[model samples]
Target chain A: MSDVSAHPSLSGYEVPIDSWTQPFWDATATRKLVLPRCADCDRFRWPPGPFCPGCHSQRVEWVPAGDGQIYSFTIITKGDGDQHQVFVPALIEFPEAGGLRLVAAIVETPLAAVRIGARVELSWSHAANATVPVFKIVTL
Target chain B: MKHESAIAGVGATPYYFRGQSAPQTLYEMICKAILAAVEDAGLTIRDVDGLAFYSMGFDSGLIAESLGIPELTFASTVSGTGGGSAGVLDLAAMAVETGRAKTVICVGACQQLQIRYGTAFSHMPVTPEKAWERAAGLTGPGQVFALIARRHMHTYGTRREAFAEVVISSRLYAATRESAIRRRPLSIDEYMAAPMLADPLCRLDFTLETDGAVAFVVTSGERARDLKRRPVYIAASAHGGTCEWGRAFHWLNMPDPIFTTAGSEPIAARLYAAAGIGPKEIDVALIYDHFSPLVIMQLEDYGFCHRGEGGAFVESGAIRINGSIPVNPHGGHLSEAYIIGMTHIREAVEQLRGEAVNQIEGAQFALVTGGPAPIPMSGAILRN
Candidate 1:
């Protein structure tokens, strides 16, 4: 069963855990980022399909992601009545991983401070029955 | 074959917002629409021998059983998923032309508000997307289109205000008609001030959580001559999708989709050729407006304007009611109820029959398109 915990600002937080996804979640619990890399094309396939989207290779493995960059983002303002909270939800891109983009929330960062081409590193946030991937803008 | 079948009648339930409307189940809304279509066609339930639909709204067999459509010889559930609204009419027409069924009615029904519509696309449990896609807060339709809109902006330098024309035009049209749920005249300031559901997309860009159902009846041109209303001839109908459009909605890594080509683009040439008319000859158009950028995409895809110039074409007032060509005089999904794309077909039928509330001047050809990219799309050309 999943339980609820509050973040600084974000709504609709539910994480999924299953066989193909358990390792990713387990790694997240330990604070690591991993993705499916194709054996034939040596490119990472996102959303973890059985066959590699690149070269139709079923031989794929979950490997660590070096890093990602913010592709595009949206500022979500959700709540009831007068009480509202704002957070940035973004699609982060891994260049060397064959265009595998991760849809994660940007936490512990001000919405105005986030940039379109901002570089971000992955961090984990525990919620309910799973660990969710959260991102923070990388400072040089 | 071009004029083998025609639309005999169209019907719809009074559209309402989630809580503002009467309490009726999704099935009841569909039944109301289907029965209304049968009555509008001036035919009894016994004459209805065919049924077609998409998105698995409610079982066709059970729907027929409920409607007393006895001995259904033709029943087709289209394969494009929800993007097959235009194709449903084609399938119904196919049934009539092939003599599989004498009278066929295509129906589409959905009550997103009741179904917790938010969870359907976003939460892809029992799949790999559960871990990567939905869990990351990218579940809403607004998110997918936000990505597409941003790409369009990046590629063509399309301004965010370029969508103002579409929003304003649709609301203005809606205000003139009583059936429109979103009748308040929308101003540019209001549109700009609307809260963001997804980046590049404000609340105005998204369609309302509509509760209703729509259906249209199709039969042979010869048989349609004896129906209740003027026969809306189906000059050409076609539908298909891109090469790699999967049933599951994950297209982040795919090469260049949505912005350039559309689900409706693949079948545009064939439909226009079959209709024996060009886009310039079309009196009105009812392109899908589930999102603002898609309306722009369809305008480009259907040859109304050059590629990547959709933003400018709409902003220049070319699509206003009295402009060179009017679009979605019924307000479309943007201001109108989001009955999937079924309402677009219903509006096209009414416009061609010269019965629209915001009727065009003696429209001859009407172009109606169905769902947007990442899914197989469909479209049809109708003549009065």
Candidate 2:
């Protein structure tokens, strides 16, 4: 994983943390990325669901999330009329997690530095009520 | 699902820019559209027995009471956003085919006075799913789809000009219609000059935020024959997508091919099978154009051309008003008004009935698609 310096403070915003996703949010406080893994099927679920789509099992555990590859991305030159702020949101795919991908911001990276196949490791962005898992570019 | 169900009439209130239709409430627009559709079908409002709607359908009981629809028998709504626009027709058709109702009204309405669609997602009360997206500063459909557009360019070496062609083609078609909000065609240079909302998607690429209502009258083929005008036969109608495309742009978990594509290939296949026709048989295509790149992607998904060849196909002027496929000849959501995917259906009905402004000579078949959304993205085929 990249250093915290590469992760920007996104503290002003608040992300709704529900019981189903509370564990994921709790793990993020320590800058640790955890995803729900089906205890029976051993498949990881993104967005932390109640049951497995494949095995339809309710038994699950939160395991440390692995690094991902940037599947695709976009740079927002402007958002909400905030002309000065630029956002780089990318779809990061975790191959080990049953190929489940998550939408995260590519923080502290120059717009020119992001590429489709770049490898990315988990990072943290602090929201008002929870710590959100973001990502930073890393060497393959 | 077959020629048993047909669209007897189509109608819409004037398309107005966001907030321009304020004096008229959403329900009022719905009433206007329903009444207009009833009259267009040469049937009195009393003849309508059922009401069908999609995308946050308003209360049917209220509408039935207000419009004084006599003896409402069937009232239902298809789920999902604009993705269910065309799917709602399936509900109406099913009701008519099953003899549950002789006449059904399929409607969609929007009034952007308070809630604007352009920045729609930003105002959403964050749920667990939205929490992940909102935290990443990903708001609005354009921002999310931009990632897919970027992947498409990366995967197929698609150029921005193809998207430009999509927009210009719609504008060219809209130029001939006084109903279109954007009638002036744009040059490639002008499109390139437009401000970027999201990288790879300029202002011109997104659909216009309009306030209006569009409605259609559907009935059994036997009854349609006795109506005022020619009936646009519902040869086929389909909704739903592959499991991989679940949640679509919002989740972005779909694998390669499915990720970059429009995610409509499966729906298109089912539609073709149900219609007993192929892509070549389609004379006009009213594809949903919420974003320009999706239009290109859908062209490929619908088999207008081979996969990954949509950019080139569109660039060759094959989607123009006089082109082989003649896509969006009534100006799609891009140049026409974006009443969700309702306008596209209206265009399909008009084209098939030989009443479209940019009419394709002897057009026999028309294809209309709902917006490229999550599971339940839909499409339909109509024949004259």
Candidate 3:
């Protein structure tokens, strides 16, 4: 029952929560950004799967995600219609998370200011069902 | 089974802009294309025993029943979208060579009226993999591939000028053909003026949203000799992806090499090995042109040039009609029509038969590729 209607900008975007992804949405609801880390291999699995891709380890633990840098970014100028607002989506790479790159929208920053390797800090936005994790560029 | 099977005929419907094919349903277009292909081969629907398709398969039962297919021996479809376009041809070839079926037909059709491919991913049930993408406002393929395009530009200095060459070159070829949708000559100025949909990707960078269908007939080499057209022998076919290319455009976690590549290196190696010829021997190339930059990336992945040299390769005017290797002579998906990657195959067969509208003189071989999308991205080599 994950909803994005609360965020008017993401009006039609809906993220359905299933058993495998329930824990992830639950953590985000508390305004915490957590990723699934393999207890046996000490590696992180993105999208929160049941087992590790490297070691096939089922032992998983929720760990706090640290700050990340922009690996790639895109400015979406054309969308569904002319009334659609332009937005920037970036792939934020976390060094501490074993080279994990997560998809996050770059908000609160000028579009032209976004670049690869720029540091980004974790932030949250309210959805109808969960808190979606977003990122803001770190100026300092 | 290299060279054991060959393409006997190819056919397609008039490509129309989205919603322009209103009165004609997708199934009707598919049926018409199949009939045209059968007629082109001098055969009837009763002669067809197997059907090979990609994506959703289009309900082969309904197709067989409606088309009055006397008996259906084999029916199968490759997974994923256009990436399996050439792979489906391989399936038909295998069925022919193994004595499972004598003649097989491969088909693909697209109608964007009910569902649009641009924002298709957003409408799907949010799987674990798509949850983050949906939240990040990454809704379409053009927006998603922009990330990869930007990375290529950052790491290798691949410029928009090279992408413009790909679009302009394809349009230039399309302008000469009567069956093509965009038959107007495109200049670099027009490409430069095109509105940017996704950063580094302009309107011309995207493949057209078309309503059309394409079909081709396949049979064993021995049986093809008695057919109506010149036999374009299937020399080799390969389809698969590397481990790092998982979910591809959806997941941006790939490391260096595969990250910047079209993920066609593995497919290319297998194709050349099985065909017993390298890229230089190919007279014409029908590389998939879903996006302008991908054409450059594939030119590298397929060994047309050294890695990261694709930008320079296109800028040198090598992919034009009189260049080293003419690519997409039928205008490809960029300027012709987007029936997935089937149009590339139709163009390949036409080139090998020496019957293409913009025919490459003495075209002995043609290379056709499937999507750079996901695993099992396929390619096939056909020789006259």
Candidate 4:
């Protein structure tokens, strides 16, 4: 059985962790964002795939995705008043990471101000022994 | 090119909330429907050689074993796409046409009433890339459709009242069917006053979660001719998909991105071409209504009307039972049990066979469509 009550604060929310995804959460604890990179094709991937989508090679390694540019985003004018009211879900793509994109919420910016192609950097927060990775606008 | 196969028989367990003392498991519901469908066609469970069902279904091995078949040849499980019903229709047609199987059974079952009530994502597989999207609290299927409803209203001046007409009309028809989950007649005023789930989208605009299963048996037309029940030929079927997850910034990147009129255009075009029939030839329709905006999108996509005119078309009450072409005469997902749109296909078969509880007179041709999710979509035209 899974530990349901241990994460009481996240009650009514899903706490997802799997064998392949544990390292990702570990990196987040140190406020770092990491993704699986294909050693053969030298491309980055999200969602911790066992093989590279670019070359379909099983030899892939996890690496840091230092920063990314927003490919697209939505302000989400309506939400259920949990994370929806405060978060701006954006699709961020890393140019140096071979167009690998991740869907993350942008912090420290008004929902209306979030736009496509916006520069952003990775940030992390701790929750129930797990670090949640998020994004914020890059300060130039 | 080979011709598509025919739907030999269709069946369903009584649709009810999961906790209604039904004493039924998901596998049991599937078995009941499969057995009933075989009986309806004057065939035996032993005749089934292959199966196609939703990936979300509870159990496949048990369903197969319960039927006590000697050997199984073909099996496919699908996820993603709200059009589970249309997917089965396509698969059934392919199964028979390819000689892969003599009789293929397609099934869909959901136990939403038994699952703990919180949100739909609770059951969804959460991957690292999807963490941020889920973390922002994007919850159920209705919520995703709600976003498109807002954009549709903003772009086409679609009034809330116009959207409510879909519910009001569907509920009015559903009331005639005793098996429908929501049979009470819904007036425009009551629809407007219903509790809101999403702004501009009221509770009435969403489908209810009920424990149920629907199944169909497909075979070659030559075989269907000798069956006990009327043979509803699978005239045409098609499917399409779009890459809109990363292109959401563009307002046009909403649910159905490929054909601009929603994915309905390609599916409908291919279906009509295969069947040698146009939208006007259809006598009944069962468009998937996970949300009401899709009804409007499908109306335009299926060539029932021009783009941007679906709001007016729905408001005209032309989709009612007595209208030119009755749509969702069984209340649809908005008022009927949400069975991943499989019930819609079952309803079409019933209409064609002249056996629906809320049967429309002389429904020789029926059109059914898939959902507006980012996944692959499908549509079918069934004729008696």
Candidate 5:
């Protein structure tokens, strides 16, 4: 486990929090990241869907997400220039969660230190009207 | 071993940057392109009895009403975002194959500057691309593909030079095409100097947004043979995604994912199988190069080479003129106008007709593909 960081420098974009996505976003407010798992298949789902994409079962449960690794990443250099934002966004994959990947902002990791398969843990930061999940490198 | 229908003629508005001197509105662009293809085929606009487009909201009835098309026996709009460019060709061919229509126009149009897809795409609300993803900084498709590129590099030791080769080859090809958007020769130094838009993807890695429309006329092979221009045979067409392979919609995340599919592999197999020819026969390729790395992936997925050999395969200069297969001789979307990948189809038709600006000697077959991933993609084979 690692300590959560503050909202990123350009992290104040208002995200549309709807009924379908409310549960996932709400978890971030408490500095937690929850993954919606197919209640029937036990497979973790992403982006919030009503049914299990695997079995088409109309059942899901948002459980506290498990640890994941840095599957891959990229440092987006071209921001619209308004956000004062330059950072590395990473795709974190859960080996336990059937290879499901969650895209999260990697904080406190230097660009040179970002490894393709490094372990990571979830952290959250409050940004305009929403709390978004960020990830911290799990250093031994 | 053949397509039941053939592309008799192809036409397009000149490629231009999205907002730079777009001479016509979207409707005007479509009408102009339709008329061009119609005239090229030695037929009147009135001859078109069916229409298909890759998801622009076109009122076929209104466009036809103006063109004096009495009735359209078939009109369809294929979906899949940018991946539908070649899919619409399949739909038009199907319409002509059936008794639904004798002549059909498959059109792809985009006014991205006026209708900034590059901007709106960052805010996409599709399934698995919810607000959380955007809020989490997974906004642009480049970033999504960037993740894929990184994984690919780690998986295969792919180098940035492989990407530069695709861009340079396409740009050099575009330099000869009068309508190509980015005619300026892109050098290795310039490509490397270009700022990274997304990590692993430089600004050049992304496709140019252009305001343009491309249209092609398709009809039965027997009818095509009678047309003025040499009919480019539609040897095969296929479209689908990797959902069955555990890929979530609009997201690259998948179980045991290779990140090489926008449903390209299976579709490529189906294409070669249906056409009764293997990859070696393809003389040129107008692969969808919305981003450069995917072009490498497409090469491999299409069985142009074995899995993981895309990096080296392209490095062999095989994708250049007279090498193995000239790719995007009119520059791809990267250098050419990104008319939503229709230019790729237009280029294929021109090549098969032996009219390509950088025509391959005795070229017979051409391959055209769509966006690399995140949805059901489309592709087709054309033969002279």
Candidate 6:
């Protein structure tokens, strides 16, 4: 992976970190993609919301998602090279985590083989004091 | 719902870069379009009581203040579908049916061309999940839609030639449209040779970003009867979303995820049912073409063709200006400019009014749609 400082410039403004998403970043540092799974509904949620989208349950807990399947992905061939270095992004759905779908990059597969539904395992890269959780193909 | 509203007026700022001579503020664009639309309707700004705009547009209070409208009655902002233009129909329906407000103005504007350029994912709210997605460099619309294009090719026997057909047809329509940013006609060979943005998706397959604003003023059919222009009635409007966001253990499990059944099966059914017309009755269409493949996908979803036959149907010259169904007569986002599909709606209204730069003769009905992915799909049917 390229250096964080070497990344391409972003548009508009960059948001500062808050407490709700802090744990998510901490888990990413360990290469684990964690989501707030509503203990009541047993479903992983997004936007780090206080309540679940399914049942609007307030009781939510951080859950570990070790593996997932590639729900959808795109291999960007154009753009800043450092930013598009064989970049393969996918929506990984974690069934164990109550079907929480998280967007991440698949680092281990060739671009051509990265199709919809490819099984991927969690991986991590440290960046700017944060561990960014990525995914890699689950090799047989 | 009384089911009686008409788009009385429409307006826009000539497309240009955000900071290029024209005003850069969304408020300025909204005012320009709204004033023009109101004037076109032979009405004054005072006639507008309610307002609906894209969530990404300028603030409602700011716009109302700028327009100097006192005691505004209704206001709303909607987003997520990228089809922010469809808000015109929704707001119009509210104004006419529920009597929320008599005259409603709907506006969509983006200064993206003036703003720093970045991937679509960059615009996603900066949460840990988004940050993780961005850190891995999976941050753009091109990449997301490319996956869809590839999948369509794999599952439906779609070919690059079929994809090229869309580019060629859109360009053909755009060539006659002076407002189109790309006036040059594109051939199949040229489209095929265009540089790839992603595997199977070429540069020509993507829409261009141009700075501009489009607006519409909608009111009750009774009010429209007194307007300057022939009022285009809103026959039907619908939006849908689906959450495969986390569903199955496999990637294909999320295949064909649709957010709005209105833009999908239900919307198509209801639109035809409400309009008392079918896809065959559509004289002109302004399907969003953020990506070429999506145009085909929406064509199928809207019942222009059967499942998995959109590619083949488009290849048959049926989407040409003089063909069975004229689509994107204003060049669409592919050739004209990408204003988050707002311009497509404007083009639909213009075609229905026989005022399009590339006007389709006697076009009575037009169908316009929003984006395909990331959920929240919306659509509208306009008739003169």
The numbered model that scores best in DockQ is 2
Instruction: Please state the interface RMSD for every predicted structure, separated by commas.
Output: 3.0, 1.8, 1.6, 6.2, 2.7, 4.8
Docking class of 4: incorrect
Model 4 residue B93 distance off true place after TM-score fit, in angstroms = 1.6
Query: What is the C-alpha lDDT profile of model 6 across B18-50, one tens digit per residue?
Result: 345254565677688888888888988887788
Can you write out model 1's per-residue Cα lDDT over B274-359, one digit (the tens) per residue?
88889999999998887787788788889999888989889889899888789999999888888888888888988998889899
Residue-by-residue lDDT tens digits, candidate 5, B117-211: 65565545534245545655666677678887878888888889999999999888878777877888988999999988887899898888888
Per-model C-alpha RMSD: 4.0, 2.8, 3.4, 6.6, 3.2, 4.8
Tens digits of lDDT, candidate 2, B1-384: 444798998888999988899788899999999999999999999999999988878898889889998798999888878888889888898898888999999999898887779888878787887677887777799989999999999989899999999999999999998889999879999999998888889999999888899999999988898899898899999888888888887777777788888889988999999989999999999999999999999999999999888899999989987788999987888898989999999988888888889999989999999888876888999898
Determine the iRMS, in angstroms, of model 1: 3.0
Better of 1 and 2 by TM-score: 2
Residue-level lDDT of model 1, residues A1-140, one tens digit each, is: 12111243223445555565666777777777888787788877666667776689887677887779887666656675447656566778887676667777787776656766789977776666667788888876
Q: Which parts of model 6 are misplaced by more than 4 Å? A: A1-72, A78-84, A92-102, A108-122, A137-140, B1-3, B17-25, B64-67, B79-81, B116-120, B123-125, B240-263, B373-375
Chain A TM-score for each of the predictions: 0.79, 0.83, 0.84, 0.74, 0.81, 0.74
Per-residue lDDT of model 4, residues B113-217, tens digit only: 446322565566765545545654455555545555655665677788778888888888888887788888877888888766755567777777677888888
Q: Candidate 5's C-alpha lDDT?
A: 0.77
**Structure candidate 3, residue pairs in collision:** none
Taking chain A of model 2 alone, its TM-score versus the true chain A equals 0.83
The true-versus-predicted C-alpha distance at residue B350 of model 6, in Å, is: 1.9
Show where candidate 3 strays beyond 4 Å: A1-8, A78-84, B1-3
Query: On a 0 to 1 TM-score scale, where does candidate 4 land against the true structure?
Result: 0.76
**What CAPRI class is candidate 2?**
medium
Q: Give a tens-digit lDDT track for model 4, residues A81-113.
A: 442343355556777666666655566665444
